[model samples]
Target: MRRAAYWLFPLIAAAVAIFIVIFMIQINPSAPHMNDGTDGEESDTSPQITEQSGSWLDRFSISEEKGYFYPVNEVSLKLTDGGTATVAAHYRLTVPLKSSYELFCVKEELKKSELPYFMRKEGETMTLFVDSNDQNRLVSLVTKLKTYQIKATVSPYTEEK
Candidate 1:
């Protein structure tokens, strides 16, 4: 009986350990493979995104322009008093923009507010055309620009046809 008792415990433990290993392998079975003369990747995910410096709209047009303005989208300016105005296109103003760097600083605001005007550079002066007949929109845009220290002008613009 003493001999049986001494061997029984170790025998039971060994059996349990063997069963545990077998169960584990059965649950998560794996197949071993030798290097199959091909790239190990079975599938690939989509590519990563890239960080661009300037607006993508600048690349849309192909022209030999020294002072190329960004994409000029035809926008119908919405009046602040719940109306639409068609007179925005006739007006233009020259912004006191020092460099392209200044426009870059206000880029976020332009995108956030969805200002519907394009700026063109001529000589040493950068021009900003207010796209809306609503004076409030113009004032709001200039105020936001001032917040960014860009100091964009809200001066009146007239286009002589």
Candidate 2:
């Protein structure tokens, strides 16, 4: 009985080990081929991720831009309040934007707020144009933009003839 007990335990263990090995092999059939006839060197199966110091948008694309004043898009002044006043500024991204969805979301919010602003994508930057005779309205709009982590300064407001 003792002999049978010892043999049974080892046999169960061996069976379990064999089952685990077989399961692992079935799950991952591709084994690292080392010194195969095709090549005498081992293949690299590790993942490679190259990272650079810039905005996540830069990860989608790269530019030789040094400062924050890179023109992202083109802007045209359109006033909902029937004013020709346009505020042009080099709107810089203060935070790492998650995605272009953030821009769309902000645009939707601005539309709901009835603020006269238009954003157009030129290359990588986005252009923001605000048309309001009352500078206070523009200031309030800019202040509201801060909630979405958007920061911009007053630049030369030009009118295209």
By lDDT, who's the top model here? 1
Considering only N, C-alpha and C atoms within 3 Å, which residue pairs clash in candidate 1?
none
The most accurate candidate by TM-score is: 1
Cα error, candidate 2, residue 84 (Å): 19
Tell me model 1's lDDT, rounded to 2 decimals: 0.62
lDDT of 2 by residue, 27-144 (tens): 9887444332356665444323334335446634433243224565864765498867665442222222345876676577568767666656667766666555555555666677
Residue 1 CA error for candidate 2 (Å)?
Answer: 99
Please state every model's RMSD to the true fold in angstroms. Answer: 19.1, 17.9
**lDDT scores in order:** 0.62, 0.59
TM-score for each of the candidates = 0.37, 0.34
How high a TM-score does candidate 1 get? 0.37
Off by over 4 Å in 2: 1-98
**Model 2, residue 144: displacement in angstroms?**
1.4
